[model samples]
Target: MKKFLVLGVLFILPIVAYLFFASGVNNFAKLPVLTPAISDVTNFKSLSEENVSLEGKITVLSIYGDNVEGREGNAFNLNEKIYDKNYNFKDFQLVVIAQDGQQEQVKSLLNELSSTIDIKKWKFVFGSKEEIIKFYKSLDTNLKLDKHLSTSHAFIIDKNKSLRGRQENNNEEVRYGYDTSSVADLTNAMVDDVKVILAEYRLALKKYNKKEGLK
Candidate 1:
């Protein structure tokens, strides 16, 4: 009886330990860095007279055309999906950029959007189409205002101003999802990337601030 009990304990212990350690490793695996730091743009302003920057917050940016049908509505859908899941993170911001002269329309769209989510975290900005395209280029995206700007897409910019797309830093397949697979897939994948950034940032802070007694 004693010999049989020992064999059972040994088999159970190794299986339990392997599962525990495997789970931890999976959680700590590194996700892609996405992109280099985003470049700055000038001549754009957020709603309510606030200046905009990519510093110190995670920014999700989408470019919209005022005259394009359903542009603002498409952006609103993506915003609602992300906000509904991750609204607890105060540093997460959604920035919608429109072509110049569309401020009133953008404002109206925002007014409607405010009824559903925290519109305070949503910023509507516009500049000349030329400058807006220039701003898009600064982020290293493939968008061209003349042809390829799609309101259905959103770019995740990290707190350090880096665009989070396709910068694979690990063997793990945890890269940003840039495909238009479906609205549900797109929103959920983007939110997962956001959580990855937050997790990495917190881990970095803990490791680097240990000696400083930082929180």
Candidate 2:
């Protein structure tokens, strides 16, 4: 009777552990989509004159405003904390939208960053002030761009052109964007959220491939 009891305990332990981890994965499968199908950036012209698009890409979108030169610190903070860690992911990109005339300043900043990091996936796009404002408004978030047409906040835009972020829960305020200037915010919140979105896509892809395999 004691041998049978021990065998039953051993058999149940593995099942319990599997169920626990599976529940955790399911809970984090999708990051909350705060705004659905926001504007795409295909209309803007990249610094290289290449066409840039937010569709079918996981974009870290930012507005450098008219004061591109003044936001150098913010750029470096994001580069070190966020871009460097995730740039290797195939569909991941960092897109900065700056006023049309700030091309030189944006180029200079990218040149400096290129010395130590791969800037290939980091794209800077140009647009008129009115166009930039129009695009920013499309996000439909409470966050505002300053008079200089800039904000320290950077947003995550998924492949479907939707704004993804944390919802208000446990008395916490809704977070539409991460503060680029705050390393703690990027490290603790932004990085983890990025991982969740990436994992979500990977799981979807696996399911798609499996379905095709059966066919």
Q: Against the unseen true structure, what C-alpha lDDT does each candidate score?
A: 0.66, 0.91
* Model 2 spans with C-alpha error above 4 angstroms: 1-23
lDDT of 1 at 59: 78
Residue lDDT tens for model 1, 1-215: 99999999998999999888655544764455556776653368666778877788877777775553457556656666675666567687777777767777777777777787767777777677677766777765554453534345677788777777555346545344343324775665766666677666666676678957854
* Backbone clashes under 3 angstroms, per model: 0, 0
User: What alpha-carbon RMSD in Å does predicted model 1 have with respect to the real structure?
Assistant: 5.3
- How far residue 33's Cα lies from its native spot in candidate 1, in Å, is 3.3
Clashing pairs in 2: none
lDDT of 1 at 153: 65
Off by over 4 Å in 1: 1-29, 143-150, 167-181, 208-210
Q: Positional deviation of 153 in candidate 2, in angstroms? A: 0.3
Give TM per candidate: 0.73, 0.89
